[model samples]
Target: MKIPVIGRRDDTADTPDHPATDPIEELRAQLRRVCGGRLRTLDAEREHLDARRRGEAARMRRVGE
Candidate 1:
């Protein structure tokens, strides 16, 4: 997904030696890392939940018979 250029600063009009560099890239990189970590944690939780559900279903079937 392309990160939108919403917060980018326009530094083209500045003096030759004092041109502005965008700081938004650093923030974007940090956010990306945080999102990746969250996804990993959520995936692990989903796997754990699925396993529990399967174990419960098996127990229920045994009880019903």
Candidate 2:
């Protein structure tokens, strides 16, 4: 299951109070990157999420801890 929406703590850095990239523009850019000329918002989101999951999993792995 996916995470629930929750308020962020002050220490978070991933998002600014106001993000520079417009969501629609970012999605369009991702679509263009993934597909040569077609729309692919789902593909973009999936790729982004998979990459983040991989990074987080690697970060959480126990390595001589």
Candidate 3:
């Protein structure tokens, strides 16, 4: 008895239209996206906290006067 092939027989599977990709690069790109989002959130939070601190300081000065 003869067995039949089950998968692609030519190297055209990795054609120019669908080139192969590096796993490490893909992970790095994903990490950059996540870190960028987190950085933006942290920056916004810092700005908000700084504003609150300044307001509180101003209120304290008024009380002292």
Q: Give the per-residue lDDT of model 3 (tens digit) for 1-65.
A: 22212332345436785444455544555566768834335788799899999999999999999
Query: What TM-score, to 2 decimals, does candidate 2 have?
Result: 0.34
Q: After superposition, how far is residue 50 of candidate 2 from its true place, in Å?
A: 0.2
What TM-score does candidate 1 get on C-alpha atoms? 0.39
lDDT of 2 by residue, 1-65 (tens): 22212333233324675344545565676567668866646789799889999988887885535
Using all chains and alpha carbons, the TM-scores for the candidates as numbered come to: 0.39, 0.34, 0.39
Tens-digit per-residue lDDT, 1-65, candidate 1: 43334466455425685354456654655566878834335788799899999999999999999
Please report the candidate that would top lDDT against the real structure: 1
lDDT of each: 0.64, 0.59, 0.61
lDDT of 2: 0.59
Q: After superposition, how far is residue 35 of candidate 2 from its true place, in Å?
A: 21
Ten contiguous residues with the weakest lDDT in model 2:
1-10
